[model samples]
Target: MTRNVARNRSPFSIWLAVISLCTAGLVGTYVLFVEAPPPRRIVIATGGKDGAYYRFAQLYANLLKSEGITLEVRSTQGSVENLKLLMDDDSDVRVAFVQTGIANSEQCDSLEALASLYREPLWIFYRGSKGIDRLTQLKQQRIAIGPEGSGTRGIALQLLKANGLGEKDDEFSALAGNLAAEALERGEIDVAFFVAGVDAKYVRKLLRDPEIHLAELTHAEAYERQFRFLSAVKIDEGLLDLQQNIPSHQIVLIAPAATLVAHRSLHPALVSLLLKVATKVHQQGDLLSNVGEFPSPKLTDLPLNPEAERYFRSGPPVLQRFMPFWLASMLDRLKIMIIPLIMLLMPLMRVAPPLVRWQTRRKIYLWYAELRRIDLRSIDGMTIEEADSSLEHLHRLEQQIARIGVPLSYMEEYYNLRLHLNLVRSRVLSILRGEAGHSQPGSHPGFRTEGGESTLAR
Candidate 1:
């Protein structure tokens, strides 16, 4: 009884070994060939100290870390420097929040956009002896265009040049936004030109002071015409507040839209995830964007990524909308795995049955060959005595096949092959007993006669 139990377990043990090897091969294939998760740490190129970009980057850093992403918000001069960092692979920076119209045309090839966060209104406040309402009035005064390589400086230069003014015509100072505002308050700088989002701390402080007036762009329409990138917007009276009743009249401003730019090599999954986070962060009903409307890819030098463009047009994918954040992220990483899994499973399901039958029937088919050999030898003008001996050999072959063991899994195909062997045996016996005619002229009982030959013999 113990010997029989060991014999039964031998096949199971062999199959277990085969399945173990197959499982190992499958796991190794998935690990080596499937898509990998994104880098754990990333750098977010932002602006210098005390700027709007730097503050926003801090918020972004906090938000990303919650999603298992480490963000290094590196401070620099501003937009131009941010673009440079993303374009240089040696820096290992992947993303940047850049202002539009400040980037060089050549740098655009290395960088594209993920989203445009908000519009950066250029707020030029001047505390001069003369009351100035237009940019043309600052032609000869010492004006601070913002720090060198800063987004403010880049926009300041263009706005001045648009109004038929240049650094040669006016004295230009390269100072940070807060520094410029303090200098203008101290009566050191004649005018301060700041390009930043609304609610910039230094700008708010300057707005409350009675000594300084927010310079309105009287030539806003003309400026927008000259520089197509500039948008003319009006700051309505008491728009900042209802109680202060400040700016009793409307203030016109010329501004450029701030865009979110990154390297073209950024992963598509990361872009999708970033856009999902940005939608939550920026789509609120604030002074900048309306509810359910933000993080747009509408304005940028480089074209939007194909997947991002599709997502913006349609909305978040189904898995993202319903699944938890981390699960959705894992599903995004496993996007390519779906294809390989289907490819692996579908064929196994279709061909396993036939494959198992072919493997198990090897010994059964060997007996059929022995029966055929004996029938051929007896057909060489043998007497009835020789024919009876051949019939005995055929019977023994059939008994051996009937006694062979087959597992339950392959029982159907195993029985079908046996049925075919039985049919062949019956026809061979009838021919030997002279109950059926062998014909080269027509189809025979044992096999079809094609081209004057049996199909099996041929």
Candidate 2:
């Protein structure tokens, strides 16, 4: 009974071992893949509230809100200020609409571009058709080159330096947007350099003004070649207004793309969410771009984010395409655990059942060793008393064999062990009969065994 009780733990212990292996694999997988959840709220630096950057940022914020993220818009002076906010390590602005050329390679170490959303045209408006078609023509003139630290100032300064404008001092007005346009109307500045979208109120107003002429950049292709970030755009005549023939002729201009940039340390999940928002907000065409031309990963201002690179290369992961954004993101994180979990389970599944069967077979096979010992003992020549002793021992062995328990699958082996026991019993009984026959002279040979069976006849 003690042996049976002790041996019964084999199957239970094996199962426990399988459970432990599964648990350890799961824990290791979880450790490797689990990460802090993406921030629920974030801030983006958009340019002036009335500008295109701010307008498009609102669209991003609106779409992000549907995904359970709060988008706070931090308005700044322009793209230069936006870039500064993104570069600041202590700032909360993780995203911004940055102009392509405003930041240099050295300053972009901590910045990454999610995509280029649209073109931010550099519009040069002046008081006359001086046919002023080049950057060198307005060197010493009183010009409104937007405010200090604005994208307009950045591009204008670069162009001035490239064109050999030696005294690039405040020969320029520090005005921008409506103020610059108002100044141009009042003849306060001879020329105004405004970097804005095609639909900007001031840009449209300046374009229609009869006194102000939009300068046609004749060397646009050269500028594009020199500054790789610039793309030469052709604005066809009458495209803006058919009846009025606004501009009255085709105009060529050089412009930089408006990039959606973020800090390098921004969370990857948040990056994924921002990419989706970019697609929703900027996938359509504007006056200059064709439909689905923007929100492109190509020629972005800052280094392209790794996730954005993969997204543009092969598209979103399958889960993201079919499931909700948050749901798919969570599943993506958990996906790393699947292979390890399966690896742990497969071996346990393959080995455990066979191990249990071998353990059960051991229980039955152990009795065969005992049966062989008893069968050998029965063949020894012995007196009637020895024969009676051997018969009693065999009877006790049969009782134990009957008590052996096994599963339904092992029942055949269980019964087979008992049959062998009975065969050994018959051999012992024959020896007892032979001994009793030889000692028939003793009257006391009519002895009874433990079960009240008299041994006189057999």
Candidate 3:
């Protein structure tokens, strides 16, 4: 009984396997053709650990960690070094915050901007009893333009050169950040230049100091025109500290926008994720920027990424609207494959059912053809011995059909074939009993012995 059951299921099992293999092949092909999954981890180059770039990068790392991505933040000297890490093909760095004008077209061919995050004002603090209104007045004084490879130094040199100072000038110093602030306070440097956010602790602390004065750029609009990336921004009176009136008056400043930049080949989904986090981090209004002014699609030194452009224009990808980050990312990767897989399977689905039906019917019909051959011999003049052999052949064909397994839909045909076999067997036996001459042609429902000819009745 067990053997019979196994035999009954054999054809279905074979066909099921065939269908399974075809499905597997399609899935494998899609996996091979689709884009590789986004990296599970990425590295970002930021400025010194105490600067705004490093602080904001840490915030991004926390946000990305919640989405199952590991964001490794590497602290560098500043924007100049950040650009170096991004441009190096051998480096693992994929993202960084770079200041505008720090990178030029020749240096940033392999990089793209996600968005401009915020404005970094160039603050020049001088210790003086008399006001210093221009870069030219401080040309001969010892000045801290930040350390080498820092964005502050890069922009300071540009501004200083416009006022006739250069590498030939022996009065330039290389102090930076807290060090630069300290040098000015201690009178080691007569002037200190800092490029940083208004909210930076050092900048706020220096603004409150009575001895140090924040020099206002009298020709801020001219500087903005000279350097297209620079914007003329104003520090309103009493905005920093209402009680102390830190600036004591409205101050005009020239600033460059800080941009979130990445390698040109960074994954599109990751680009979107970074942009989303940037908007959350920098959308608030500060002294220089109005609310929602940043994460702006403002063109910077690096060309804007196409994905970042689309995201700013239309919002997040459609799948990401309702799903969690990891699931949305997986679906976005797989979305390209959906249409191609559908194109492949539709025609197969249309033809598969009929092909199966024909296969099952053919199994039953083949034995009927054999039965017809034996029936024809009985009519075409077989003797008693030949009739006996034909009868035994018909019985063997019957046993074969009985053991064969087919779907229930084909059972009617199976039984009808068996009924025809029985009719032919009866006629063959009659011939063996010497009674073939008495039976009229066409008398049997399934067999036709007229003119000693056989017809396939199925």
Most lDDT-accurate candidate: 3
Poorest 10 consecutive residues of model 2 by lDDT?
1-10
In TM-score terms, which candidate is top?
Answer: 3
Kindly list the per-residue Cα lDDT of model 1 for residues 89-141, writing each as its tens digit: 79888888888788765746777777777778888888844678777788778
lDDT of 3 by residue, 1-458 (tens): 01222333334644575577567866886678768778889999999999999999999999889888899999999988888999998999999989898889775788888899889999999998879889888867898987778899899998998898887874888899998898888889899999998888889998988899988878999999889889998888988888998678888999998899999889888999888888888889587888988888884876889999999899988877788778998888877677766765676666667767777777777676678788788779787567766776776676677888887978899899889989998887666545434445454333456467543232
Residue 220 lDDT in candidate 1: 85
Q: Candidate 1, after superposition: displacement of residue 354 in Å? A: 2.0
- Per-residue lDDT of model 2, residues 146-206, tens digit only: 7767888888888888987644454877898998899999998899988888888888888
Each model's lDDT comes to: 0.71, 0.81, 0.82
TM-score of each: 0.73, 0.77, 0.89
Clashing pairs in 1: none
How many steric clashes does model 3 contain? Answer: 0
lDDT of 1: 0.71
C-alpha displacement of 457 in model 3, angstroms? Answer: 29
